[model samples]
Target: MVRKANEDSLRAQAPVFLVADGMGGHARGDAASQTVVRVFEEHIESGAPSTPERILDAIHSSNDAVRDLSTAGDVGTAVSGTTLAGIAFVDAGADSGCQWMVFNVGDSRVYSWEGDRLHQVTVDHSAVQEMVDAGLLDPQHAESHPERNVITRAIGADEYVDADVWLLPAAKHQAFLICSDGLTKELDDDQIARLLASHTGEDGPSTADVLVEAALGNGGHDNVSVVVVRAMIS
Candidate 1:
């Protein structure tokens, strides 16, 4: 529900949500993340519906805002950028109909828990992931690799950036999680799974609260941000 000042800015509205994790030296990092959140909020306030094209446009607008800041010397940094991940809900036109559209850039992640399985919905845009994809490194070795934190893409780093988007059907009792690499770097997938499972029942801690606690408890070496969405039939 809330992101640390050290973390990126986060925005959520019911079923539609987004998280952006920033990286840069000086205050540029904070500027980039805040700019993204502001752009997203503006679009939502103007009543923009959850659509792929609309979301993409919003991201582009955010990138431009950051670039403008850099050009205006407001950020005072040569390079500043952020990773983004978000989900939008869609109506399936039936009594129990709903679906989700997921999008991401850089290393921010989205996870879906359905049945008894946990699935990673976003692909990381880091050097380690690239190496794994190229068969130069095993997937299991990516975590501890020296270049694990080296990201290949970010919102304002380049003139343009590509985002990965996917359409998925909604599932009963399913949960969606979006988080920055800070949490993942410290906690393994298994540990996250266990936490999600344990918090599934009654009045438990919100996902954001639980994840923050986990990261702080683990080390809190970096900023941590988490957004969780639970699906329910209307």
Candidate 2:
């Protein structure tokens, strides 16, 4: 409830489900994240599965667009950056069949949810995450660490983007959760799982809506963005 502006943006329609949490405070974050959505919308056509190359191209193009939003000050350049996480269905090849491409940059996340279980598919590109990986800090304490918000990488923070990606076979049943750090900071994995596992009927509020509400209720210290995608391949 403390934010002056919502710096989070998302594109949750079919074919592309992504959440981008913009950096650079209220002044520039909203534009940075929205730029990502707009660029992707332009690059990837609607109502069809895209190729891996197309998705990758869109990401790189998004980085360039976000970078263009930056401004140079007398002291230094004020860089615009955002955390991006998304899932898309891609045509692998004649032999490889189709697959789900999950990609992430910075601390936003993509999770695979199946059988009422939650699994993190993308690793964070943040200072605390590196500390946790190097055994310098406990995973449990990483979130509350003073440097938890210091991201090591972002879409436009550097000239070259290093996105973490994973490919999963398109199966008969699949569910995914894409969210910004706002939700995770207020709600842990257990809370998120319980909410996602709860059977919200067609008439009820969506799981994504419920999760965002839960975060707002908890503290709402930041902008929250959530996208829940369920695919049935037959």
Candidate 3:
């Protein structure tokens, strides 16, 4: 099972298997995250697969909801936005696979782990990430960058947002990890790779719980949320 704050606002569609992370000032963050989750939940509850297109639409809807909430002045001095990542089971040709779709507005991340390798599947929409992309800064320097926490795109920050989406074929027993920056900011890919390799077995959770626990053990300074899923053949 994925873990987050007791008061955390989160949504998950088990059939679709997705997670969203929200960021905003004060309680507004909670509200934004909750709103996105609620939107997805409504669709899934209605027996929708919550396709990639539907996921994108839900994100836009959540963005509108946040904007509306901000305009209504209910949150009061709080700007709201969130990051979203999800997977939908799919069957293409003779192969049964899963489609991985991610929509992130901030620094939260999605990763895929297979064997001893860990791969980051989502790019952060943050200042530090921009710098790294432009070659203005090395990834090694990102951890201590003073502007590491400054994000360039987010929900409710503006009227328009662009999300990166990808379709990946899931392999049997491969693990998918979705988490907030609170966790990845402190843990490196190699560390994550090691944990995934070490804890995977018959008795394991078959997800990324060990990774989340490692981050918390190092001191969970910010809100930490994680969802781990492993693909299996029936």
lDDT for each residue of candidate 2 in 16-128, tens digit (9 for 90 to 100): 89999997442377888999999999999988888888999999999999888876641123578888999999998899778999999989999999957999999999999
lDDT values for all models: 0.78, 0.89, 0.66
How do all models score by TM-score?
A: 0.87, 0.96, 0.82
Poorest 10 consecutive residues of model 3 by lDDT? 1-10
In model 3, the runs with Cα more than 4 Å from the true position are 1-8, 24-27, 45-48, 72-77, 90-98, 170-173, 201-207
- Residue 145 in model 2: lDDT: 98
Strongest candidate by lDDT: 2
Clashing pairs in 1: none
User: Count of backbone clashes for each model?
Assistant: 0, 0, 0
lDDT, candidate 1, equals 0.78
Q: What tens digits encode model 3's per-residue C-alpha lDDT throughout 106-171? A: 677778777777888788888989999999999999989999878877666667767777777655
Q: Which stretches of candidate 1 lie over 4 Å from their true place?
A: 1-5, 45-49, 72-77, 91-98
| Pairs that clash in candidate 2 | none
Q: Which candidate has the highest TM-score of all?
A: 2
The weakest ten consecutive residues by lDDT in model 2 span 70-79
Model 3 residue 65 distance off true place after TM-score fit, in angstroms: 1.6
